[model samples]
Target: MSGIEDLLREDLRGKTPYGAPQLDVPVQLNTNENAFAIPEDVAAVVAEFVGRELRGLNRYPDRDAVALREDLAAYLGHGLTADHVWAANGSNEILQQLLQAFGGPGRTVLGFMPSYSMHPLLARGTATAFVDAGREDDYTLGPDFVRAAITEHDPDLVFLVSPNNPTGTALDREVVEAAYGAARGLVVIDEAYAEFARDPGSTALGLLEGRRRLVVTRTLSKAFAFAGARVGYLAADPELVEKLLLVRLPYHLSSITQAAARGALACAARLQSEVDELKHQRDRIVKNMRAKGLPVADSDANFVLVGGLRDAAAVWRAILDEGVLIRDVGLPGRLRITAGSEEETAALLDAFDTVLERRPALFDLQEQAK
Candidate 1:
């Protein structure tokens, strides 16, 4: 610990955001972002909208984020209005607001492991307790397990992720219903990959509308291909939405972001088609990898998890040199590959094959060690 940093928050010691890897690799497949570029029309709309605001840089943005909220609520199709929405730099910050509103010392936030890495980190930021719901070997949560955890910990916040990252599995509907029955806590389902899933329309809102304790988080980074834009949304009961709005910084969503998100929403047909294309490619990737004797997780989103690769980091390093990049899950012997355009996907698999074929000695070592 640096003795000179005495003014820092006591909890800040030895903690930092999850460090994403940076590589100069050619084909980047690491972050689960959409590889497609934003539609030309959508980009033009954002440019024109922000062009109007270029001279207003000195002025503060709408503190309430009124326009973006209204558009988002309507896009969600849940009888929402501006009062029923809130905007932040991304859903990540929106989560921070939820924690602030509902968390404090001794209060606990609960979630499963190998899910999003941010859940526990954010809970710690609130000075609240954190708990985990254990999953079976396959990463599926049973209704019994959920009920057991709720009965045991009784957390104040429960984070859920559908079509989870790194694993790419979706929670079964029955399991979701049972989860709602199990907890009195605020249940937050992160559907950041929802748009790329089979039925992106099945948001948790429809199941528990008017319930002030339930919240749904979505991001435009994936489907809209605007990850750099940092625009995401929250769908909750109007009362909860109002609370988040009150806590958020003013004009968190820039004019460009608003225009870009709205433009993408208007071109839903094109976006949906892109999502469909990604899904098809993802299926083929999973199938081919599985047939190659590589263990892959069943996925409903735009990515696939290929397991059984010994030394995920070593494999990742090799892929980088092969002119491809994939996410290092840090889980022993596991790697996550994002679904890109058909050509991109092919390039990734070719690179994967090259690495695995030349790597019999690594796999032999792993088996011996095990």
Candidate 2:
């Protein structure tokens, strides 16, 4: 081993960095990024605000990002205010900060498997113990199962990703509450895809009022077409938000970033229209995949998870050879497909049909409803 490797922290020595291939392909549907680009009017607003913030670059940006937090509070609209919100570069940083404050050596962070893969990485980065639990065979997590895991693991931090990544299934509100009641420490609900859920009320934000230990994180990356802006925030009791301040680095949110997020919030109407269209595409993908007898998960996010393949990697390569890129998330016999533009979706379906025609044995014809 290299001398530098020997000098590295023990917990980090053998760990590889998180990555998703960013290949240049004709129809890219691997990452769950918003299909639409920022509208011209919204782009103008972001440019204007950023231009104004450039003059004050000499001074330090707002250490607390108060103005941006206020705009985010208004955007969330669940009786939230600046004091109840905290902003960061992205949800990853926010999660890391939470671990810094609530998790450390000897403390445990627990999450169900097949959720956001980053949960364990964030825990390990903070020198925290990570516990992997299981979901139902169908990938739906029930309250009883969650409560049992919490009771057994007794983790210092519990992560629940609604509209979970890779699987794209959302948690019921009752399940969230049960987890909160069972957990002795902090509970964070990663709702990064909440904006695209089938029902507007399918959120843990409403459950935040009386629950101080509960946290709900939201991002502008998906539905808002602001992934490039890297804005993610959390809503919780002001007391919990205060604890994060102790661990967050000073001036974490750059002046340009703050202004850009606020500008995106100002153009919420246009952004919602884009989100609606993406939802349409998501539903269309789900419908078409099911008709072909694939077992597709019912999704509230901008993606669908399909199973019953004989070899997922082989299918993934076939799709790539057809100039379409989708994600093979290492789930046995399954692949995740991001909802793209109408033209892109059509291209992907055509690619799937053509490939399946050649290798009809690749997938099972019996459809499993989820």
Candidate 3:
């Protein structure tokens, strides 16, 4: 019934892809997006920036993304200049670039399990082996585990996310430092959620002080509220930056994208207030959820992960019917709900309460287990 193109990859054939809801739903807590809208004033600036570049649309964008990179370096560096800064459509692309450059053809890409999911996906799509040495049930990464993996897997590239996705746990500096100790391969720290990390200064980007082989990837999508802008940057040593550039698509970042990204970067202070507001709300929801005996993960990112439910699908289905769309991690009862605005957060809580109540069998088991 199916054509040959459908079975082309052979390995990828019959694979069920992961996806979020496409149906129109209110209070979308599904995607880990900043629920707060970009402030009108900032939006105005971005609009102006785009307007300025309107005529240039006929021509190609800056292939090197020099202006945007300069702005990102300035914002992230707090004035220090680092030529290692690079950009792409989204930090996701930046990640793919790293994978393409370091991992391919008889090499392996290694990452801890239950991460952003793209690590292994990228490896698979590019004809590489994916090795997951992720944390077990408790969800903590031990330096010993990482060290053992390096010795065993000898991966060409290792991918890690701090404030790791789905589960918000962050690998502390010590663990990361240990990874950097090895001189063999590149370690990419996907800091896409770094905007909401516990302490901003403690970011891997700043930690790079002068280290080589540690590439820290960041995005404007989260804290900057620029998800539609598709802007993300990587901070690394100049040499590694050069290697990544070799494989980057020409004129990869559009001029409009560059202008908007640069404009947003210039307003970090303004964005921090929004981040603070979201964190406050997240803490409140988390505390209340845990107080009610729900097992929530220690998330270092913008969302909260509520695990240990009896049936994740039941909870997800119930909540969607209630007009709120929270993301299901497909891990059976693990939901990654974004920290929405105050009203949205309240609606989410109400939805959860309703869902848990309706799924009595599930919650009953939860209580009995507790």
Candidate 4:
């Protein structure tokens, strides 16, 4: 008999699952998670909200997640109502549902490379062909560049990640409009890190007025310190939201999750109070790294991407040896680091200092070239 490996789909025969290293270290600057913990006041409210649902354990959750969707809509505040919003266990699920509804065998989904990484993986999971159009060498997307790529691929779905992961590059509004104008398919703007953006008003949410094909995905995980809760949502046209219901599992979101998310939404202000600080640290990282002769990407997210390493893997290992964990996003000479609390940030910088003192050749491109 053939083994399970032999029975696996040919496309998935050599693929790796999407994940970052989950290791115990003195400081973790990987994965781009909010470093701050949820405040006690917010936790108490979430606990009370979740407690109320314990008595209804036997009953399935609200299959529609109507109230949760309402709360998410209110939080988003783009003149969107519950009809225009949808919730899921996480943004990853939301993306998957979209792929299921709009992308499948023979359909294509196009995305810029070095993005959230999961965009293509989710496409593959749904049997959708993924196309990488790639970005400029500096990792910025222009309106013309976006339109050209969308026109060339003519994908069924287009993913544009603002304050994009692993690079922290935010998409300009014109670029989003350009992609939407050129594509005949659904346009997805993954704004998972929008709360950390330098200009809060630059959100594509404002452009949702007449565009039915546009979707903006958001998550409370980063700003609200709710990564563990796994709450994510999206804002789109009501018709599109309805289509997701067909592909979503019944009672997909648990009552506890809905209640907790609602409670958190109620306390959005308090929960997101640390966002400014995180942005401060993000800028600090870019400034500090650039000063050290490293090329750091300008970030509007809670993380910074540093390039110019002679050996990124070796630098990663050296930093890990100092008990600091950052991400080596498979870029040849680059690494991504999350903005942590002041103390954690200091630890990360110190770890880098120590590593550079001992292994300058690994981190200093000039030295390596010499």
Candidate 5:
């Protein structure tokens, strides 16, 4: 082993970093990024804001990012104030900070499986124990299952991903409440895809009113089309915000990032207008895939989880060969696809059509659903 390799932290040895394949394909849907770009007017404003902030490049950004926090709090209006919101590079960093504050050696973190893949990685990165729990066969979480698991494991932190990744299904508000009630420590509702939800009001933010241990995290990456800005924030009790501060480094957010996020927030209306079209495409994909007898999970986000392939990896490769790419998340016979533009979605569906036409045995969803 190399000298540095031997000196690495024991827990870090032989660990692969978390990342999806960033292939340069015509249609890239592996990662759950917003398929659209920022609106032209919003881009112009963001450019101006960043340009103005460049003069202050010599100085560190607002260490607490107070102004940005205020903007974020205003953006996520569940009666959240600046003190109730915390911002960081992305939701990954936000979760890591939470783990740093509430999780460490000897502490356990639990999440429902086939959800966001990063939850356990963040927990382990913080030196916290990681535990995986399964969802129902339909890839939905039951409140009773959540409570029973929480009661059994008694983890220091719990993650309930609304509009869960891979599965593309949202949790019931009752499930979130059950998880919170069962946990003695912190309960985090990762709502990174909240904006794309079928019902915008169906959020855990309402459950946070009187609950001190509950936290609802959201990101500007998806609906705001600000993934490049790397802005993620959470609304929690003011006390939890205070705790995250202890573990976060000084000036964690750059001046450019702060200005960019605030600029995006200022143009929220223009950004949200694109959501309706995206949802239309999302629903279209679901309906069409179901008509083909595929076990397509009902999606509240801008993606769909499809099952019934005999060889998911093979299908993934065949689709890529057609100049389209989706994700084969190692779930047997399943793939996750992010909703894309009309043309891109058509390309994806066409790719699948070609595969199924020639290889009907491989695309049998009815039998696979069993």
Candidate 6:
């Protein structure tokens, strides 16, 4: 008899699930989660909201999630309304939904490589062809390059991640405009880290006026310290928002989740207060790492990507040995670290120092001869 694995989808049979190491370490700067705890007042409010739904657990939540979407729109404030927004479990699901609606079988979605790694995985799960258009050596997306790539691929969907993951490079408005103009299909901008961006006014939300094909996804995980709550949403043309309903499951957002998210949105200001501090720590990491002669990428996200490692894997292991955990994102000679609270940042810096003290040559760009 054949093994059960033989019955699995051929494409997913040997693929690895998307995840990072979740070791229980003294310091975890790997996942780019906001390190601060929710404020007591905010926590109390969220608890109250969630508690209110206990009596109504027997009834299904509003299939449309109207009130939560309204709260999200108010928080985003780009003249958006509930009709233009949709919520889901997380931004990953939001991306998956987009692929399900617009990208399945035979359709192609083009994304610049070294972006959110999940973009391609989501495409694969939806049975869509994923095309990687390489970015510049520095990982920056130029308008000319974007336009040319879209023209060549003629993809059905294009994913542009602003303040992109792993590298923390933010896309210029010209780049987004070029992509929108050159692509014949939908354009999805994953802005999960937009709250951590240096220029608050530079969001693609400003570009949504007449572009029905554009979608901007946001998450409360990074800036709002609500990672555990798993609330993510997207803003797009009302028509596009309606189309997602066709693919979305019934009562997708539970009453508890909806209430908790609404409660969090009520305290959006308080939760976002930690954003400035996180940005400060991110810049500090860039400045400090560069001062130590490592090539650190300029970051508009909560994490910084550091290069010039002689052996990224070895260095990662050494750091973890010191009770700190950062991410080795499969980039040769490069590693990524999240900006945590002050104490966690100190611990991370100290761990790096301890690792480097014993192996001063770790910063050497060239690999050792075999």
Specify the highest-lDDT model's number: 2
**What is candidate 3's lDDT per residue for 1-370, written digit by digit as tens?**
9898685797688766756676687788888888888898888877888899998788998888888878888887644454879889888788888878887779888888888877777787777788888776666777777778777878888888888888887877877887777527888888888878777665777667667888899889999998988888899888888898788988888888899887787678888999998888787678767876787865678898887677788778888999999888777667788898999899989987887676766653343211
Tens-place lDDT per residue, model 2, 1-370, is 5699899998898889999989999899999999999889999988998999898999999999999999999988989999999999989899999999999999999999989999999998999999998888888899999999999999999999999998988899999999999998999999999998998899999999999999999898998888888989999999999999999998999999999999899999888988898899999988988888888878999999988788999999999999999999999899999999999999999999998899888887775655
The parts of candidate 2 lying over 4 Å away from their true place are: none
Give every collision pair in model 4.
none
TM-score for each model: 0.91, 0.98, 0.93, 0.97, 0.97, 0.97
Candidate 1 lDDT score at position 273: 72
Q: Regarding TM-score, does 1 or 2 come out ahead?
A: 2
| 230-290 per-residue lDDT for model 4 (tens digits) | 9889999999999998999988999998999998899998866799899988888888787
lDDT (C-alpha, whole model) for all candidates: 0.77, 0.92, 0.81, 0.90, 0.89, 0.91
Top candidate on TM-score is 2
**In model 4, how large is the Cα lDDT of residue 254?**
91
List runs of model 3 lying over 4 Å from the truth. 16-18, 78-82, 364-370
- Write candidate 1's Cα lDDT for 147-194 as tens digits: 788778888888889888778887766666777787797888888888
* Alpha-carbon shift of residue 186 in model 1 (angstroms): 0.5
- List pairs with backbone clashes in candidate 6: none
Report the Cα lDDT for residue 14, model 1.
68
Model 1: residues >4 Å from true position, as ranges?
55-58, 363-370
Candidate 5, 1-370: lDDT as tens digits? 5797689888988899988898898999888888898878889999998999998899999999999999998888878899999999998899999999999999999989988888888887889998898888877889999999999999999988988887878888889989988999999999988888998877999899889999989899999988888989999999889989999999999999999998999999888778888888898898888888887877889898888888889889988989998998989988989999999999999998998887787876665332
Ranking by lDDT: 2, 6, 4, 5, 3, 1
